[model samples]
Target chain A: MMRAFFRVAWIVVKKDLTIEVRSLEILSTTIFFAVTVVLMFSFGLVVDGRPLNDVAAAILWVAIAFSGTLALGRTFERERHNDTLRALLLAPADRPALYVGKLAGILLLLALVELVLVPLVGLLFAAPIFVHGFHLVALLAGGTIGFTAVGTLFAAMLVRARSRDVLLPIMLYPMTVPVMIAGVRGTAALFQPTPDLAVAQFWIGLLGFFDVVFVTLALWTFDPVMTD
Target chain B: MHSDFETLAVIDVARHYGRRKALSHVNFTCAAGDIIGLLGPNGAGKSTLLNILATLLAASRGRVEYGGRTAEQAGADIRGRIGMLGHDLFLYPELTARENLVFFAQLYGLSGAHARVQAALDRAGLGDRADDFMSGFSRGMRQRVALERALLHAPRLLLLDEPFTGLDQASTKALVDRLRECQQAGCIVVLATHDLDIVDGVLSRAVFLQNGRQVGEPGPGTALRERYRQAMTT
Candidate 1:
């Protein structure tokens, strides 16, 4: 069963990746949106001449969170369109495998977007992002996993609803606030000259706990939702 | 085990949709090589019955036993032994024909996914199209791909809901031929189709359903048409 789960997970992830590669809509759109958010924030903050550290984390998290939500919504909407969601449901594999596969795919995309946005945000805001490279990267990794876990599950649910396109962001933003909060705070603390491992560890620990709880719940709920 | 080899026994299966009854006190049995055609006007619970057997939906009451094990006790294990083709094609249009089959074989935990995929395509008469992208294929080709997917795992039981839809004459002939191959392999094939073309040769027995009740198990000759006529009038 474990083997089947991972095998199915890999297949689903490949399918999603292939779709993105073919269309290029998700990759290009998310990058453009994230960059725009960064640029808009930079413009607003430039006139005041405030230090970059004050709002750098907030700008990064908000931009990444909304862009991530858009990408997640598109992933599921694509599945529901051709009844590929039903195809996955019909596969003779464990349901958690589906969840893990989708979660991994979303995280992969999120990681790619963040990879570019991180450096750009630093250059635009004149902040010391590279100085806290390892710690900040770890914080982003932890928060992205947690965010995608909930986002993928909710994306599956919203795809079947009547107002799926509109309802997704409204539903996603509230659930994602905690991860964003922990992520922004951790990143902000890491930018300090004396980086606080304690703050970073706290948020990472919280992110881990969130992953465990939601992943378990998502597994249990997926069977019922996928069937219907 | 051989004593119950050909039996699909159901013990008082019932289903409910909230406060409404979808299926009520249904009981039936089918033997190996028997292709029973389910018939009803609409909302006669045909889908509900097929859904339970396909393991896609659950019954609110009673149990289903196939080859002597309760379906609930052997859900995952039973799924391995059953092939299902529903209204959904369940294929990735972006992927090649071979890729889709390989993926499903992996899901079924088959180690030699490559050989199984080849065998399935060969049987479906799609070996030449194996490398072709699926999006360009016609509906008949898609249906054939779905049929091959159902048989890739070598399921002991095949459950098809409205399998005859969207097939041209040649493809339909190919489908009937493949179904015969399945029966020859000793797999119990259950077809939920409205097409009465197979009333004589394919199925040994047919169950006539009307308003969630089994009126009778008609024999191979002249029974399906007679039963369908009897069902509609009454």
Candidate 2:
């Protein structure tokens, strides 16, 4: 049973990856959007010769959150265009397996965006985020998991709604407050001149806990929420 | 191959959206080898009935039983055995015809899925275009691919709604031939369409619905168009 579940999930992942690889639509748009936002932030915030590093953590999280949402929307939007989500729902595989598969795909796209955004932010803002690279990676994983867990659930729920474009962020942002806070604080701690591993670990731990809670919730609720 | 005990019993099924009723007290029984045409005009609840049978939407007031088990009782196992092709193509336009079939076949847990996907592509007469992206296909090609996807699992019960929307004459004839093959294999087919000519010679029975009610059951002897026109007017 578990093997079948994974097999189905792998198929879904492969399908999404194949489309993404061919078009590069979601990845390119998301990365471009993130970099543009980061650029806007850099130019908008100039405080008396203060380095951008002071607020770089917040800036990075904002870029990720917004761009992640964009990626989630585009990812599910593809399904909506051809009613492929309906086809997916008709499949007899476990619905949670479907959710996990989509979550993995969205995570991969968001990771790519972050990979580019992190380096770009380092170069433009001179944040030195890579110096504490391990801590940064940990924070990114936790925050991303939490964000996409709930983001994926909502995105699926809203896929068929006529107002999905406006509804997605409206419904998503409020639910993800804890994730964003932990991400910003954890990243901020890592960015400090004298990095505080303890603070960073605590926030990362909180983000991890949130991810566990929401992923479980998402898996449990996906079937009911998606089915009529 | 189809199930020996193929039957679908929709008993007193009804669906409502707040104060508006989409379907009410709908009742029907379909068995294997039956090609049932669901004829209705606009707002006559044909799509809603098909959706209910597809398990995409739950009937608010009654139950649908497959092989003596309710959908809730049979669960995903039953769902796995039912194939559906609605008005939407239910395909990823970015994927090639072969890729789309393979993906759905895998989702259905078909063993030797790659070979089965190839077989389906061949059966759909899309072997030559299998590698081309669906985004560039004509409407008839997309319909053929959608039909192939639905048949990939060899489902015992097939539900199709407005499947002839975009097909040309040759594609439509190809679809009729495939559906005839399905019926011969003892697969129950419930086709919903407004055009009576499409299923005229193929349909084993016709059920006419109006305002969420099954107003008439026109058998093979009766001209379905006459029945449909009468049902809608009165």
Candidate 3:
């Protein structure tokens, strides 16, 4: 049973990746949005050609949150476009396994976006991202998991909804408040002059806890929410 | 992936959308090797009934059973035996015929997927077009491929909603032949369609539905389409 769950999850991941790699729709759009948001922030905040304190961290997390939302919506929209999700749900695969596969795909997509996003933030705001890169990765991984875990669930719940496009961000932003706060604080701590590792670690730990609780909740509820 | 299920029992199944009833106390049973037709008008809840049987939608009241087991009791395993070819066809336009079949085959964890997909492609007369993107395929071709995709697991219970919505004569004939093959294999086939003409030789018995309720079977010597029209009007 366990083996079947993992196998189904992996197959879904492969199918999603195959489609994404072919179209590059979500990847290109998400990257462009993130880059543009950071650039817009750079122009508005860096008024005197000197960066505002800790704004790079704030901007990076915001770009991720914003771009991540777009990616999630687009990913499920593709499923709804063809009603392939119905076929998938009709399959014998475990519901949580399907959720895991979708969550993984979104994570991989956002992670690619971040590869461009982090360096852009560092360059634009002179944040020391490279200096504490490892700790920063931990923070990003934790925060992203929390956000996408809840996101995959809600996006699925809304796949059949008439107003999914308008409702995604509205429903998502409020639920992800804790993730955003912890992510911003953790990365902001890393960009500081002394690099407060202890504080960053604490926030990362909190994000980790949030991921665990929400992932469990998402896995538990995905079947019920998706079954119409 | 031949299922051990011998019967699909739908008991007192009623479905409601808000205050409107889509199906009410609908009851039927299909045994293995039975090619049952669910005939009805546009608002007759044919598709709704098919969706419920496929486990894609829960009935507002009552339940569906596979081999005397409720879906809840059987869990996800019941789905393994249920194959559905819905209105959408469920084929990704971006993927090729081969890719689409292989993906679904893998999901079912079916071994020898390559051989099975090749056979399915050949069966659909799509062997040469296996690698070609489905975006370029015609509606008839896509329907054929989608039919094959749904049967990749050799599901014991096949629920098809308007499996012949749009098709050429050749495709329609091919689909009827395929349905017969499934019946020979002891697969319980339930189809909901408005193609009353094509179902002449295909349906062993048909259950007419109107306004979400099952109308009585045709009186002896009443033509199927005549019975269908009577069911719709009276």
Candidate 4:
């Protein structure tokens, strides 16, 4: 059973990846949106000779959060377009496995977007994010897992809903508050002149906890919520 | 498990969508080699019933049993053995015909899935266009690929809702031929379609539904159009 679960999940991941690779729809749009957010913030807030370093972490997190939401909506919107979600549901694979598979795909795309966004934000805003690359990656991983875990669940739920475009963020943002907070604070701690490892670790741990809780909840509720 | 393994029973199945009764007290049984033609007008619960049977939607009141095991009991094993084709083509427009089949076959966990996918594409008469993206294919070609996808796993119980929606004349004849082959292989087939003329010769029995209720006892050889007209009016 475990082998089957992993195999099905891998197949789903491959399918999504192949589609995204061919179309470049989700990755391009998400990265563009994230870059725009970073540029808008940099232009709006950067004062005379004073970097927006204090709020750089907050800006990065907001960019990721909003762009991640966009990726989540698009990932599932593709499924809705051809009624492929229903096809996946009708397949014999485990429902939670499907959720995990989609989560992995979304996480991969968001990671790519972040990879580009982080450097752009650093170069544009003069924040030295590259100095704490390891810590930043950890924070990004933790927060993104939690964000996409819940985002994948809600996206699947609202795939067929009429108001899914507006409803996805409305339903997702509240649930992801912990993720955003942990991500922002962790990034902030890493950016400090004398970085507080303890503070960053604490927030990272909280993000990990959020991932565990929401991923488990999503696995349990996916079958019921996705079915009629 | 061979042909004898095919059996599907819907016992007192009722589905309600927030007090709107889509299906109420819907009951039917299908055995091996049974091609049951499900006839109903719009909003008569044909798709809803097929969805329930496909395990995509749970019944509000009753249960669907396959080969003496309810879906809840048989779980993924039973689901693995059932194939369904709904209104949607269920193919990714960006993927080629062969790629789509390979993806689904892998998901179904079929061993030698690549070979199976190729065979299915050939069987669907899409072997020549296997490399072309579905986005470029005509609606008839897409429907053919969808049929191949449904038959990929060689499911024991095949449920098709409006399987002939977008097919051209030749494609429609080809689909009817494939469905006949499925029936001959002893798969329990439930086809929900309004085109009684197309399916009349292929159906072993005809089941008429009206307003979520089974209206009449129509035998396999009964004239379906006459019976359907009578059921709809009276």
DockQ (Cα-based) for each candidate: 0.47, 0.83, 0.80, 0.84
- In model 1, residue pairs whose N, Cα or C atoms come closer than 3 Å (at least 3 residues apart or on different chains), thus clashing, are none
TM-score of chain B of 1: 0.91
Point out where model 1 deviates above 4 Å. Answer: A1-5, A40-54, A157-159, A166-171, A191-197, A224-228, B1-6, B197-201, B208-223
Off by over 4 Å in 4: B1-4, B218-222
| Per-residue lDDT of model 2, residues B27-59, tens digit only | 889898999988887887889888888888888
Q: List model 3 lDDT by residue over A1-228, tens digit each.
A: 889888889999999999999999999999999999999999999977778888999999999999999999999998998789999998888988999999999999999999999999988898888898899999999999999999889899899899998999899999999999999999999999899999999999999999999999999888987878
- CAPRI level of candidate 2: high
lDDT per residue (tens digit) for residues A1-228 in model 2: 999888878888999999999999999999999999998888887455455555888889999999999999999999999889989999989989999999999999999999999987776676777778998999999999999999999999999899998999999999999999999999888888888899999998998899999999999999988878
lDDT of 1 by residue, B1-234 (tens): 222345687678888889888777778787777666676656777777887876767788887788767755665556777778876777877788998888778777788999989988887778999998889899999999998988887777788877888788888888888888888887787777778765346765565566766665543346567757765665
| Model 2 segments more than 4 A misplaced | A47-49, B1-4, B218-220
Per-candidate iRMSD: 2.1, 0.8, 0.9, 0.9
Query: What is the TM-score (0 to 1) of candidate 1?
Result: 0.87
lDDT of 3 by residue, B1-234 (tens): 333579888999999999999999888888989999999879989989998888888989998988888888888878988899988989888889999999999887789999999999999999999999999999999999999999999999898988888898988999999999999999999999989899976888898899999888767466778878887777
Instruction: Tell me the lDDT of model 3 at B153.
Output: 93
lDDT of 1 by residue, A1-228 (tens): 577678789977987898778778788889899999999989987655554555887888988888988889888877776566765665667877988898888898889999889998778766678776777888898788877888898899877688987887787778878888889888878766677878877887887787778778888898787654
Predicted model with the maximum DockQ? 4
